[model samples]
Target chain A: MDDATLVALARSGDGDAFGQLVTRYRRAAFLVALSVIGRPEDAEDAAQEAFLVALERLDDCRRPSRFGGWLMTIVRNRSNNLVRREALRATEQIPFSARSSTPTPEKEAQLSELRDEIARALGELPEVQRQIVLLHDLEGWKHREIAQRLGLPAGTVRSHLHYARKSLRKLLKPGE
Target chain B: MVDNGSIPLELLDPGNSDPGHWARFQARVMALAGPELARRRATRPLTVGEVLASWWRLLVPASVVAAAAMASLLMPAETTPGAGIAIEEALVAGVDDEPLPAVLVADQVDEVAFLVAIEGGG
Candidate 1:
């Protein structure tokens, strides 16, 4: 069934509808959490919490068609909060990679050297810039959509994207 | 729509990259998110209905108390002390030792219409 149907059913005390809704979006929700928080466990937590919040507040959804984005925003905000807390911990740990676990050669080589480089480059970007890049390039969100979701001016979003990609290109250029 | 426009095509495409780029990303993403999902499930908060149910349970006793208070207010006052004493006294003095009090004055109770009629007849 469509998300709208599932959401409506879930609102009427149907647990099955809610379960279906969770299954359908769990992957994307996870990805969104991972990107924002950079830790697998934290991302999973954030995603699940977002889903539960969505379910609990299902009635507050003004546009049922926009439920996915609405739900994701909850995850994004929660993950961001964690990220901020960790940053305040006075350590510069990489997001999402295991703590105390060094990168293995095989794992490093799985992605093409350039792709790996680009990925690392993305990780290195400032938070807002990286978000802009990910929303535009990976998540396929339109600039306007990203602006609305991130609560930034469209021009600011475009500027962030422009600088982020340019900086990434320079950082990921051949031979370093 | 492979239009790179002014952008470099190489940035978007890695000729030697893993053939399963999307799949690999999907795996990493899921792995990273699994535990988060579990935590979220564990901490699932109460819904609106649950909240309302709890609230109603709390209100029921309050409503009952309020109703009792209102009923007490609307009821008539207890019998006056003087009237109660009169009834008890009349019961003791009456023929059967139990008065069927009718709330009558002392004059009404003392009336002797039958005695007066007998005297006139004589």
Candidate 2:
């Protein structure tokens, strides 16, 4: 079902409908939070908190059709708050076994290393670039969709994405 | 800008690699939000008809009392008991045939003389 239909059903207290919404937007929410907070664990926490907040303030959502954008805003705000609260903290290393569920230990280690490397590279980019790259490439959102949701011009989103990818490539391949 | 399909950015997304993780995340959110959703359902806004239906008991008696009061106010004053008697008394008093009696006039003079004596003493 579309976001509007799901939102209406959820408003009527359909737990399953809300669960579907959570499932649908969980990845995007996580990516958005990660872009802001720069930590997977904290990003997950922020996303979870954002979902609960959205549930509480669902009635205040004036436009049910644009639920994704509203939820993204909540995720971004919550992530930023988390960042501000822990400004002096150091970045925690991503645990290989904790985040990876590959069939083999060797593949798990490799995937974890790649994830960490990409995350580090992403961290070096500007916040908007991180958001645009993750939403566009990782989350597979169209450029126009990202522009509309982020309230930026389509050309700006494309420019940011181009620069973000270029930076990531350079950061990842400095030896080359 | 055409996206470079070669970046393998999907490696950074754990949700796709580990479905169980995302499942747990969704389950956790639903568990935490269940109570709030129930509250929303419980406190949903009532429709106009529902509001009227719920308040009919109080509204019915109040409407009856209001209607009775309006009817009483609109009724002609002649229907009331002693109303005609009061009008007749006023008309008779306006054009009475009797002259003042000597004893009653003497009583009035005595009251005025007593008040004047009290004021003089004070």
User: Which regions of candidate 1 fall more than 4 Å away from where they truly are?
Assistant: A1-5, A13-28, A84-108, A112-116, B1-122
For model 2 the local lDDT of residue A138 reads 81
TM-score of each: 0.48, 0.67
TM-score of model 1 vs. true structure: 0.48
**Shift of residue A116 alpha carbon in model 2, Å:** 1.4
The deviation in Å at residue B95 for candidate 2 is 90
Worst 10 residues of 2 chain B by lDDT: B95-104
Candidate 2's DockQ: 0.23
lDDT of 1 by residue, B72-91 (tens): 99997785656555764666
**For all the candidates, what are their Cα RMSDs to the real structure?**
14.9, 17.9
Interface RMSD, prediction 1: 8.8
